[model samples]
Target: MNYVSKMLGAPDISVTLARAAARRVYGHSNRTNPRAVPTSHRYRVEEVPPALPRALFDTHFAPLTERLPSVTYEMQRYLRRAASLRLAELISGGTWRQCATALAIPENSARQTLNVLGRAFAPDSLWPIFENVVDHIAQELDESDARVDYVKRRRLMAQWHLPADHHYAMCQDLRKLRTLREQSNPSPIEVLVWSAVTEAEYLHSPILRALRLSAEGGGRSLTLSIHRLVRPTSPVGGSLRLRPTD
Candidate 1:
């Protein structure tokens, strides 16, 4: 009654014989049993395997689908920031002017605060791509007066020492100095000292006032200069000279 029984032309087919026949037909084995063959020589219908459950299907695919979009978005953002930094470095290093003429921007206009910022924050891991973005910003600034002027104004104000009323400006400049200090290759102390001086000049706060007071008080007076300390004279001709004890 079963497919295997019909194939063997027998009233019943042994499970072992059916399994062996299936294996041979599927190419797992080459040898066949001649005695097990049926004279009818016709194939019978085989039962289809049961389908996998929905829960198992979801378990296998859900995680991959959930993570794919997040991974793609992060990679795209990383690439963009990387490219921006690369272009910035090129412009900051003074190479942008040469290339700007072809792009119809004045050399002066090509320099912008954004390009400087890009160069300053160039991503260490993605330096090359970021440099390209800096270059693009430079090129764009070259062609547009509005962008160039805005960048120039920002840079000028960034470095300018506005009076203490502009506490915000001083804060911005100090923040930039701190950022630069972290990135500079020089000794950290030296960078810090420079930053302090820059901050003092820009902010004119109590710290700078104290520093000025200390410098002015360091023994410089409005009278004839007098040596406050004495040193023993070096021995000459084997005789040490002594000051007269008047």
Candidate 2:
């Protein structure tokens, strides 16, 4: 089972159908088998915070019986508060320091923070923390070039390798740049940051990489995971196994 499914107590999927479905849905990928299940109108259900609707399991019923027997930690570090707490507990020693490190919070506040997290009844408060934690993990992942906010023009210019005299030209071009930014529909800041941070080559910083992963499926992954954790057990079984593609 994948980390998301395992964490949610979702049953394993059928390998053949999962593979065929992924290929059909996403086209063939040489790197690995495609594994993301689509959230089409056929699978759509009314979703509220912290509940995995029965429709999800019912709709995807055909391919979830057999086990896929593997897990991924890359996305595990990016789970919701409760799942993250569960993960922290599962880590070696399960110390406050360990939990602190995992949650990207200060060691002193680790125990208190976890206590609060453990008892948090509402999902609203936890989401922001998840974003902040992921950014911290991204910063931690990249050890060599320290990550810092490049919000200022001087810093942005240095990052973008722009000549001092080009500031006015670039500012003027912002109007024309609107069309380019519209292609991806990225935020103004995102476009500005991307242009500055990634000069010629797309050398994404750790935070940007984390942001990209977090933005997958329009932030549906985290929401799904949250819903999964809220209702962790399911008796339903089916016949397909799925794994994430590169």
Candidate 3:
């Protein structure tokens, strides 16, 4: 019985010594080699501005009042003619490269022109008349595949580069224009016609002014007269006739 108790006590003593030695070694190692400790992150709190009134917010950011400046009509007509010419060039020639050369424009310029036309004559707008021109050109060409490919490529390019928010802003502007026109009690047709006219003027006024300035600076006098006639009663109604005189 005494020998068994001594054996048990010996094993316990060995375990206690082993634990003590391990503790000493660990403590010594920690003292000699301190590890890097991560610092706690600090955050800053900022005060936000007070919310603006809903009406004021809408007026400033998403205004529902769009007025067409007087020049848009002439600009629209010019753009339409230019669009038609571009489409004709694209369809008559097999390749845009040849068309660009014939038109004395760079390939990139031609592509940009087409992109602008596409946006201007969007399907949802009151420009379906121009769509027929595109359809005619597409049909006249034996290369339907080419037309489809061009559309796909153009769409991809637009998606990749065009600002998505600008379109939304334009839509908001249109809504505002409609609201303003309705409140004014003017016929929407007249408003649209006037808007189109103003759009042209807006585009051309700067050019015209620059031209006049150049003439003045060069010691040459210039006289310019523009007459615009709207024939709402003609067989082809709602047509704007522009005559420029020197």
**Candidate of highest TM-score:** 3
User: In model 2, where is the ten-residue run with the lowest total lDDT?
Assistant: 237-246
Q: Could you give candidate 3's per-residue lDDT for residues 175-244 as a string of tens digits?
A: 5333433443222223223223222221122223344467454211111112212313331211222212
lDDT of each: 0.29, 0.30, 0.30
The parts of candidate 2 lying over 4 Å away from their true place are 1-79, 108-112, 121-246
Which has the better TM-score: candidate 1, or candidate 3?
Answer: 3
Error of 1 at 89 (Å): 5.8
TM-score of 2: 0.20
List the candidate numbers ranked by TM-score, top first. 3, 2, 1
**Each candidate: RMSD:** 34.1, 20.9, 31.3
lDDT of 1 at 151: 29
Better candidate number, 2 or 3, judged by TM-score: 3
lDDT of 3: 0.30
Candidate 1 local distance difference test against the native: 0.29
lDDT of 2: 0.30
